[model samples]
Target: MGKLYVVGIGPGGLQHMTVRARQVIEESEVIVGYTKYIDFIAPLIENKEVFSTGMMKEEERCREALRLSKDKIVSIISTGDAGIYGMAGLVLELIENEQVEIVPGVTASSAAASILGAPIMHDSCNISLSDLMTPYELIKKRVEAAAQADFVITLYNPKSKGRPHYLKENIETIKKYRNGNTPVAVVKNALREGQEYEIFTLDSFDDSNVDMLSVVLIGNSQSFVKNGVFITPRGYKL
Candidate 1:
């Protein structure tokens, strides 16, 4: 039977592509992904076809890959670790994903944390600010809960064109349970060059500083930055 590889391309750059992801991409005869993600891997394919599209087309994209995988080797690309808001879920939902192997990559959250010096050493919660799919009220509830639960929170897809107001709303929700002085860090384009990281108190976040490519980590009560590094104490090491 033909095989499929659900490869996470990490962020936007080729260098972030893991060795295994590269190997699988090199072996695949077809690559399927959103247009930008396809561009990230386009150089790796040797005359292989690429199928690309816009948002909310996950099922369509996965179906195309699944059909091709029935006869030829194929890989579906994602921007971050496949399990976290990546193609792994959509592909599995569309087909018997047992036919595919998932190749993990450096996730934005992990990369962001590494650059900021580990705000996630302790358990944290990740919430996407995009409420186009999930209800805004639900998003607010979850953010409030995370804040009340005293967990660090990493916000993904925090702002975009159509959903511009949600980031502020999310922050407001966090305020309901967290101090205005709570620690927050933003890491943009981590690991792939043009990377920018900022560590500051929650009260000072400039909304313009964040984008779709960024991961924003808000620390719990114990997180701190030292020697120019942001850290959340894990209580295990150092």
Candidate 2:
């Protein structure tokens, strides 16, 4: 049986991807991923057979990768770390007994954090605002819990046209536990072409700037901004 590799391409840029991720994709005879992610690595896969599908076709893509991997070496790609809100879990769920290799890469949270200074230098948690696979109510509960606990929170899939109000609603929930002046950073297309970012306070953040391509980071009570850098101290004596 041929080996299957689930690789994370890291923020849609070749420079951000790990060397092992690039190596595995190069070794694979077949490449599979969402259309946009495939396009991110277009130069590397010119000679390899590529299979891609549009949004919301994750199951179909994973199944096709499994089928192809049964006889041919296949690399299934996801943006950022495959294990974090990516294809690694789905692929494992679909093929329980099969041996597969998971190659981790730079997740979006870290990529965005680097661009925004050290907003996650202390304890942190990630919560997705997307309710497609997860219920919104449950997502809210987690948001509240994380906010209440003073954990630096990184929100994934924060908003889209269809769910435009979700990010605003979560911001309100966080306000209950965090001060209005708490620092927040929104980074779009991090480490990729056309990247942009802005820092805001909890009460001043405009949800209009956020979309599926953005990663939102909210600081805890002790976080601060100085000279435009957002930072959360790790409790080191200085």
Report RMSD (Å) for each prediction in the order shown: 1.8, 0.9
Segments of candidate 1 deviating more than 4 angstroms: 96-98, 236-238
- Model 1, 1-238: lDDT tens digits are 7788998888767877889999999888888999877876767975988888997888889899999999889999998888888999878877764488999988888878878887898888889888767898898888888988989999999888888888887777777777767778888888876888877787887778888988889988887778987888878655
TM match of model 1 to true structure: 0.93
Q: Across residues 41-77, which tens digit of lDDT does each residue of candidate 2 receive?
A: 9999999999999999999999989988888899999
Measured against the true structure, the TM-scores of the candidates, in listed sequence, are: 0.93, 0.98
Worst window of 10 by summed lDDT in candidate 2:
91-100
Indicate which candidate wins on lDDT.
Answer: 2
Which residue pairs of candidate 1 clash? 10-79
- How much does candidate 2 score in TM-score? 0.98
